[model samples]
Target: MSSKNSFYSIAHQVNKPENISKVLPYYSGLEIDIAYSASKKQWVVAHHDFNNTKHYSLEDWLTSFKQLYSKRKSKLSILWLDIKTLDDNNIKDMLSTINKHIPKNISIIYDLGRPLNIINKNFSYKNIINNLREIDGIGCWITKEDLNLVSKVKNQLITDKVKNTIISYGEVVDIDLEVLYKLCEINKNLQSPFSKVFVWNIQYIEEIDELIAWQEISGMIIGYKKQMWNDRCLDQLKYLNDLKVKFNRNTPTTF
Candidate 1:
């Protein structure tokens, strides 16, 4: 794996403390989604569509994360905070809670949902960006199916304020290298070009190799669904580890 690119495990689907223990050690990044609970007036770690009865409060989840990070003393390179519901109060609360519990070592990426939602509402996008400007990174979901909407959001972020934004293309149903290359080209041309490109719901391991070849892109984060982990997933992990070793060996020694 290139130093600029990394792997992330989509632990939101499993959304359990034990699953974090199982997956955190294997990857450089962990992707988790949080939904706001109006009644509780708190953010809980759960997918948006799921019933709210079982999820862990954002505070509790972060506490568990802190304990795990301490015990392993492992480098948790990226923390992808996928905000399922965004509002002024919850956003403030979430940021405050994160700052208090999560260690400073981890880089936090705010993965906001689709771009059009922001564009449609008055001042909504700006408000979100203003809040996110303080984070290490910001990402928005994009797909080829909606180029116009994607272009609008891309143009808005090109301004000077927002930095280290990522364009996340959901799921890998098929590998269209040319299309992906073009997307990367557009990203590079942005005044504030995206610092990374991420993809989830990956089904084939070879897609990883293909995407890695595109060094023109700033960085890449490959993700897998939580429930899909099996022997093939193990194979991919092993392959990535081998690549890391090879990369380390090839670097010239500096004395």
Candidate 2:
């Protein structure tokens, strides 16, 4: 996907097993929280730092998801894994689990808090890991928290051969609209450092409208509170769903 196109996936963060089944059919993208479980001696799906008795094993979750997906005849475009905790001790196990569980066709996006030494290890899964440095929520290659440094970060990304990125879009500490547009323009070029740009921290209908209007974002991560999807929110989701279907028809698959 490039900045010249408006093809973007509307993703929802479903952190619970019960909710995953409920949400699988509505959205093409699902953002999940992954962490190591000491009790289970395996990876589990949960938003907390450590897995508890209530948490389900990652393998079980994926197995159930795959079964439900087949039964529902559903499709998932992206599986965004927010790595709550990762270290050298468990990296191998995590990767092995991923290789063994996830379907071959589904794409994975790893959202890590920092760079991992073994991050470059070869994996059988189709995946993309974001650049390390971050400020306010946007991940880029920089040591400081300055939006003005994005241009420099862009060059560094290209030099490092980085191809994917994630940005934050919130009312406070949000990226400037003009800067976001510039970043989008970068993807329009053949040598664009970032081929896929995903935005998160979005909380309002207007924010969704803005992304739709820009037509450059590759994906948007949305979170919901209980009883939060008002009529307008539902309307925006429908509009985004239509846009996703229309643009996906012409755009190539991206991770």
- For candidate 1, the C-alpha RMSD (Å) to the true structure equals 4.6
**In order, how many clashes per candidate?**
0, 0
Instruction: Give Cα distance to truth, residue 106, candidate 2, Å.
Output: 0.4
lDDT of 1 by residue, 96-134 (tens): 788788776676777777776545542334555665534
* lDDT, each prediction: 0.60, 0.53
> What lDDT score is found at residue 149 in candidate 2?
44
C-alpha RMSD of each candidate structure in angstroms: 4.6, 6.5
TM-score, one value per model: 0.77, 0.68
Residue range with the least summed lDDT across 10 consecutive positions in model 2: 133-142
